[model samples]
Target: MTFEDTWKPKIDAYRAKLDEEVGPYKALVEGIDYSSENFNAVEALDTLLTEKDREITNSTAKQLVAKQRDGTLTAVEIYNAFAKRGAIAHIFTNCAMELFFQEGLERAKELDKYREDHNGELVGPFHGLPISLKELMKYGGKVTTAGFVCYLDNYISNSPREESVSIQILRKLGAVFYMRTAQPQSVMHLDTDNAITGRTSNPFNRKISPGGSSGGESAAVAMGSSVFGIGSDIGGSIRVPAAFCGLYGIRPTTKRVSGLGSLSGGAGQESIFSSQGPLTRTIDDLEYYMVNYINMGKPWEYDPNTIPLEWKTGVSLPETVTYGILLTDTLVEPSDAIKRGLAYVQDKLRDYKGKKVDVKVITIDHDLMKEAFKQTLQIYGTSKPVHDKLFAISNEPLLPLTKFFLGFANPEENDILTNNNIKEQFKYYMYYLFKDQGIDFLISPTNPNVGEVPKNLTHWNYSSMFNLIDFPNIIFRTGLTFDPKVDVKGPTNVTDYNANDYVNAPINLQLTALRFEDEKLVEGVKLLDKALELA
Candidate 1:
């Protein structure tokens, strides 16, 4: 049978399941036209949202929680507003793999009742806040296909004890799960396209991708349907989508947040283990979720793999914060838009009065970076066998990006032990650079291009390099957008340059720190954001 003939029925079955799961809420976006060369989901949502829906969805998670605690807003009110917006967003961007609005509403009501019975006291830190989830995570009673068509009917347990510790923690802290976002076919690509949901488009620009495998979470948050969402990153999954969607996201050091029940191929591959973190509209929310999740949730008790380290809420910045900036990863040169953003940040730091800032333009060891990049691919490819087995079950054809990834996942790859040894050497080399220079943080571009052109993103050198070394990194917008005429590509080695493709795509950068220094990294980026006047 041809690929289409074999996979068509499976795709139809999955879509039917999604429609059944969403129920009546599916009708909210039934008549909308989502096909267009140039479409903005956020703007399209603007026309659909009511005045109240606009106000509720516009507020940050912090703001919503504050209001809920103050008795000004009810959990049910917040859920309803987001339900409408999330449903609309799913239609416009194909962001949701499943929507359980009714289930979410029922939980919201329970929370509201709990607060009322407790004499107006709050439930927890994240009281009444709704968090969209990446489909890979194990949610009780939900089918977590992890983007494979074969697992559509497979259901997780309905018990909280069976869920991911991160999910368990969030529930304890009062988080509502209304929707699960889509991901790429293999959950290995840097763009979102699966046989089940087709593709998740950029909220800012429909023609381009939001980013993958957490691309749907980024799109859902960017579209204002979710204030914050959980996403996982092994390679560039979390940070790339956040940068592409103009949001704040973190790829915390591995085992910081429990990866206990998260679903993905390469499950036991430790050469580059995945880290789960929150992606949000504001930088404060990034820290807000992490601090509470670690300190309040205490994930280590549930997941033995989790580190028992506490996240320090208040990290004091040093008198002088030294930043090391890299223009290129020496693999793929950053586009003109990203270069301008780095320059803008450099200029801001040079003139800032908030703190004593020392900025240095440092060149990374190109050879070392190349070695790390090579190792990351080998480590990632080790899971190709797992993916091959899953795809064979449904006879599902590989998506464009998955096929590209399998190209690197060579069958003749070196053993995992060799890769880990090389990874250790690479980590020490990076650590020595930080120590030798006394650099507080390493700032670099989030992606080679400012915005992703769907199915065209081929480089992960910048973001994935951090994954290779197990460093925690946070993505923050540069408060700049691509200006086609002004940010035109100058004479360079990039052969396929198009200024028009990156229209209005925000330029963002990654702020990284040494391994297990996630708290300090968040604090340092907070300081930098203030200095640059970026909210």
Candidate 2:
């Protein structure tokens, strides 16, 4: 009885089986018996960290439509202060999968009757704001359950899309698709969970983890419950839940946001690629919706598999840059709150903009980048209709980290024929680390523990090594703050993740860019997100 008294009764019988599967969905999603009447909510939020019109809940659907056309606010009181702070953030972070608060009260009374019959604005720039998505895109009549259950009787399809091009380019830029999220049964796990929404935690620390196949839209826009969303990424599933629930995501590159009618666990193993972007909480709302909603919704002349190269915002580098830190890794080492949040972004790029930055914490010879990120997640779970519908979803019981990694996912069925020889050694180690290391983008430590615990996300192999170097990464948050007395453990660390016991978890702050350089990683992290005021 000694391995912490043998996993403390298997962590107290899975903490009473996750409080009998989250105690009746936390009393039917947080009206928790209206706490015996007149329940005041707008107050239950601060935990996800401040807001409800004190602004900056990572604003930016073009700065909430330019403060609802400069009357300073009121698209129905910013839609009743983000729907009363996203209804107490889905009643304390279950981070909903589809609630649409009665369709956000009929789209905030039709945007307050078109701002009271056009005496003012909003018919674009995400008008009323509020965002969220990650259930493999496509909404109208929404239902995409990527977390499998035979697509939970799959929905979405409103006659139109005469052959969808990201739903007619985000419906000609209006951008207001309410809900559709939750994944990880055979979306091939990063963390979410299935059988109808299981995991998705880390609204800061509901015992860790939020990252996954876009962990329920990175825990619904990191608990501000959708100030932005829409995700997809092959391995680092959109920067692993935006670096385990801190928030910002990007994962652009591949096709620069356009997977036409998305949906992909493995729909056509299509060259270890996979993209589709956005998961915000602002880096100016991920470059104002990837430069006015996916580069002015060009979508490569309507998805000929986009990439006619559009979104190239004004990037003025050369203030003396040369980043390439990996904050400890002899196979992994991040956790003194992500090595002091990557040393607070290398001292805000060398003392809050004096510039001349150049970190090189190198040393990741993961012996072939860890077998090319486990053969690119075995050719990304080579879809067979999500492993034959997770054994017809119902038999419950497989989460001990999904029998610690697909429990022989039926005796390792030839690990998807060596995922194309590990995708040519992960595209020749991303052309030998970006054209033989001229070093422009490669900062590490996005995972090795930052958000975990709930079913313990077994060290999400450092953001799946940028999905085996397919690049295009960004997950900002590093507004660092988790002080266990300046984060412990050091005694001459000889690596091997400095004696791992879950790489010391505790997060917030993770950035990675290049390969379609997310508009210079959102203008070098919005100048350290305005010197760490974070938005």
lDDT of each: 0.85, 0.61
lDDT of 1 at 204: 80
Candidate topping lDDT:
1
C-alpha RMSD between model 1 and the true structure: 2.2
- Could you give candidate 1's per-residue lDDT for residues 243-286 as a string of tens digits? 99999999999998987887777788877889999999888888
TM-score of 2: 0.32
Summarize candidate 2's per-residue lDDT along 1-535 as a digit string, tens digits: 2323433344345335434433433533443432322122223455333355547454667667877777677655665565555545555554555555556657757875787698886676666766666766756676565655445456777744622456556645555445556766666566777645566555655545577777777766765656777778776777878877667777777876677776654677675677778787667667777887665777877777677887776778766567677765455565566677777777666555445666665666667766666665555445554554553443444555555555322336446556666766666765566556666666677666565544545555566656555567777776554554655542122233222322323355555665667688677666666655564
Please list the residue runs of candidate 1 whose C-alpha ends up more than 4 Å from where it truly belongs after superposition: 1-7, 17-34, 159-161, 411-413, 490-495
